[model samples]
Target: MKPTIIPFLTTRKLNPENQETPIHFLPQTITLKEYFFIRNHFEYPTQTQEAYFLPIVGEVIRPIIFKLEDIMRMPSKHLMLPLECSGNNRAFFHPKVYGEQWEDGAISQGLWKGVPLKDLLALIGLKRTALEVVFEAYDYGKRMDLEGDFHFARSLPIQKALHPDTLIAYELNGKPIPFKHGYPLRLIVPQWYAMASIKWVKRIVVIDHLFKGPFQEIDYNYYPYKDSDKGKTPVAQINVSSIIQQPQSYSILDNGKHVVEGIAWTGTGVIIEVEVSTDGGESWHKAILGQEQSHLYSWTFWKYDWKVSSKGEYLIMSRARDSFGNIQPFKAKWNRKGYGYNAVYTVKVKVE
Candidate 1:
């Protein structure tokens, strides 16, 4: 069966095509695999499942190679993780930035099944000198900005790599991962941006020092200003954000009461509350929050009752607050690369 991917702007050539899910289709507890957003940095590899093998090397006491079956034989874990592209809301940035023009659709939650990454680390026995773990994927291609061809690679500090929730996921939402979604295997890092979760993973290298790959040292880094003394910081966890899924932008609705709903999430911590404003930001009301299956990594659904009494246009907005006291800003903080745009989302709707 063909995947049910919602269409979005294609940021790159045919290989690294990008697509996002529509906000109206995101009210469910778990986003369907077909509707999940796809952001590829390279073409999907055609490696067969049986030919897939993961090599664990570098500063490990015993370097080991794991085939698909070998990993499947290990203890399996299931986690509900919501993965968001660091540039999810990049389109809203002022002055127009380079890269994908993603809106709120570049986020989705899924039940991932795989072996804990720590378990694999334990089996290999990390050397005392190991400081960071690097993940490499089969996808490789040349970019205009970079010289020569390079495979997709990223690294994590030893602490985050060893987190219990980290997994080598092979299944998404109870089905074998689709090729577009990763296929045989991928890394799922809970609470982090999707960039940290390398897809089509082929190798796990435990290094004694930081891994300075292009992705880690360049592309994903964030710079606060166009010209600043402070260097760019690596994009890691997601910021607090929410989206109004119902009564989508420019939708015409009957003049009556309607329940406005959407999903809220954060990588720093659990979302504490979500507030809704019908009259732009002039006034706000607390929205009813829903139960979260994964308190730390999954998105929380929220709803608000709107009693539209007049026939006119309304500017509906939604902002979320996380447990860490971080709330979605009225305007997104402008960054050089246009990463992490978590501004309060506003949609204009007509009531008649």
Candidate 2:
């Protein structure tokens, strides 16, 4: 159960066509407390501290039930990484898709402090055969299915679980997490988008087979294969993506020299080339890539300097080609529910 005194957090809603979508940044520039973007799956129930239980069971030598306070009593580590929703840029797709139409701001980088999962697993004892780690959230009272009420949970592969980067975060930015963004505790998965990071986290289950809970089965997970493709399989990993930060969508710019900047990251490999095109997709110019970052899963800043001549409305687009030649297309791999959108980012602007 969630603790009492859950505070109300503020967030800005986005209008798809006008802006680039709010990236859910934890606005550090202003405000007494950091902001949080709540992903409301169901109604919020009054959560108490006692009912907030974390069951560490399945494929374990000894099962242990952990309390929210117990985990907090342990050591805490702090680190920063960028996290974005997998369906963040989905609304930009011409036909439009389901899920929240997020702006680039939905992606934010922040510092988090929490006890490492590996440490907790050691205290509880781990079985050698354990291959996956499952996290269950408290807000499972209401759901998107007809099976009545069930708990909301998600799982991570054992390999990624033990990795140093994965965190059981309690604090966002410099303060404690607000109720809206999974107060008490939440899972943070770097490199991958927000979906990998489970909110309102409560339980951890170690298992051998893939843990197919409601969120896993009915939502979040997607098939890279199109509807027309037969015998297609649903994959769980996130795809590569990049987005322009400044001059979102269409900003009026006077015909002059300007520098364009953005951030890019890949789930599989490194981003080798980020090309920018001012005139549709005909010609391309290479952007100077920044230095390699330390955290393999975090995004890196990229920029390109360009000069504009004459006056009229112009459309600018950016396409990222990773080291593997996986180029960002104008249209993403479409789906009934938008999951991975690696389409070429196009922004229209008037040049006076």
Candidate 3:
């Protein structure tokens, strides 16, 4: 069956299927599956739930193959998580990074139901020498840079893999995960960017050494020296960031009271504050954080009431600060691959 596309999402690519969410109009706490942003590196893999089986092997005393029925009968866990594309807001990067030019909507939060990966590891009896856990997906395609077709795979540190929150998810928002997202099973790695959450998971390999796949060593690594490959670091945690959902750029409004609201999230810790700027960063005020309950890995809502009396163009900006005191920077550090662009979000609006 052909996947249904929402009219509001901004289309970036067709074959691999990348779309940005229309976050401006979405005011709900949890993003619906249809409205969530879609990011894919290769063509979607076709898998039948009845025929699917996930094998866990390597660096384990008791490797096991689990079918969909076995997974469903195991213990279940639920978590509210926000997943953001590593390249979200890549278009805004200075020097024009070459990749998907996503804006602010490449993120969405959902309640995921699954079995804890730690439980799976416990059942498999992870060996003491295990260093990393690699997840291989069924999706495979040829890349222009690589000669042969490669399966979409990524690895997480053994500690992260054993974390209680890491899950092998099968359901999204109380429904079976859509094929476009990840049907039968997908890994949900909290705190880290979504790339670590490999979809269409076919195999899990616990390695005694680091697993350096193309997605790990080549693409997601942040090259600070732009032209050179020195001092490059792996992109892991999501940087503290905020997006101005309402009063979009180039919006014209009458001079009066307006409620400017948005969302802020961080991978390191909970977002404690979000500040707003109306005079192009000249002055700042804290936005009132919504009283709604938010989980550790979910985005927090924030709003500010602005009463404008003068008529002119106003540059509205929002900066978020996390519990760890990591605040959004004026301009995100430039990188070659354009991953993790978390600069303070700015939107320009006119007041009549």
Candidate 4:
């Protein structure tokens, strides 16, 4: 196993390990490549420049193979998108759940440059019968709970697959993607959770029916309580959420005034407002919103100033609301898989 290069990120291991960026390092609009969160289901695959080729097959007019040079020759698109793990904030679940116990750091925004997946799909000419597009990655390994080994694969609806913003990314933050980040090529599904953006992409297959892979059908799904009427749904887009990045949680500060800052993001729409509560949930104050990228998929930075009149223990919390009227819930809906935990976040600190 490769050691984590980012010293500050928290690492969790199963068969393939994953790392999350620290909250304190999230103030910047564009996260550095080194600090980007890493979630791997299998060991990173090794690909040489000479051996890289992406095959597009299954329900298509003509099966086509795209080499790295071919993809680079296509018109490139650059987008600043925020990718969050569906299981972000899973650590806060009341009953401890299985899987990565991510806090608020399993997310990062980056400028990605790549060929639009639609452009590639156009090259192969998708048949009218194609209903779903399956993306296959090179990484393969065994699961602790499952019986045999399998490669990572996920499918997106025909509409999402053809979305102009969806990309087969080759560059991250203007540089060639690092080896740990899928190197030559990866999928970038703009408004969806990072799981939908398969890394180390080696094949794109158009199918006439929905995919039933383990990662799609069994895992990455939200299983609600038995008594609830809500049926099981696949985890996709991010929920409205906010986090406190500045004034590290539980830090001792001199009595005076301090500025609290953090980020707010949503996959449904643009984040319009963020509210911060200094004393738990008793009173709330609106935070000053910072300039955000024109892209609706990017995160909005926000800050609020708090005047500390005396020294005492305080609970700080933040909640975000999106343009679609979706707001962070006080208590996240529980699910067996611990996916999409986007409840209001709170941190306790002391003033000396």
Highest TM-score scorer:
3
Error of 2 at 330 (Å): 3.2
lDDT of each: 0.87, 0.69, 0.90, 0.87
Model 4 residue pairs with clashes: none
Range of the 10 consecutive residues with the lowest summed lDDT in candidate 4:
6-15
- Which candidate order results from sorting by lDDT in descending order? 3, 4, 1, 2
TM-score of each: 0.93, 0.81, 0.96, 0.94
For model 4, how does the per-residue alpha-carbon lDDT over 34-130 read when each residue is reduced to its tens digit? 7888899888777766337999999999998899888998999999988899988898888767778888889988999999999999988999999
Ranking by TM-score: 3, 4, 1, 2
The most accurate candidate by lDDT is 3
Per-residue CA lDDT of model 3 for 1-352, tens digit only, reads: 9998544888999888999888888888888887989999888887666336889999999999988878888989999988999999999999989988998888988899999999988988988999999999989898888799999999999989989999999999999888888888999999888998888898999999989889999989999876799989998999999999999899999999999999999999899999999998999999999845447888998999999999999999999999999999999999998989999999999999
Write the number of the candidate with greater TM-score, choosing between 1 and 4: 4
Better of 1 and 2 by lDDT: 1
Q: What residue runs in model 2 are displaced by over 4 Å at the alpha carbon?
A: 1-36, 51-53, 67-70, 73-76, 223-235, 269-272, 290-292, 321-326
- Summarize candidate 2's per-residue lDDT along 1-352 as a digit string, tens digits: 9777433332434221112223322223222223334455555545777445777899898898878788788888876665566666666655666566654545556677787888888887888889889998877665545558877777888988887667888888777776666777888876565777877887788998998776776677564444643433444545667777655666789888977777776766667788888888789899887747555555666778878888987777778776666778787876656777778877788888
In model 1, what are the clashing residue pairs, if there are any? none
Model 4 ranges with Cα > 4 A deviation: 1-7, 49-51, 226-230
lDDT of 1 at 317: 97
Model 1 segments beyond 4 Å from truth? 1-13, 49-51, 227-230, 292-295
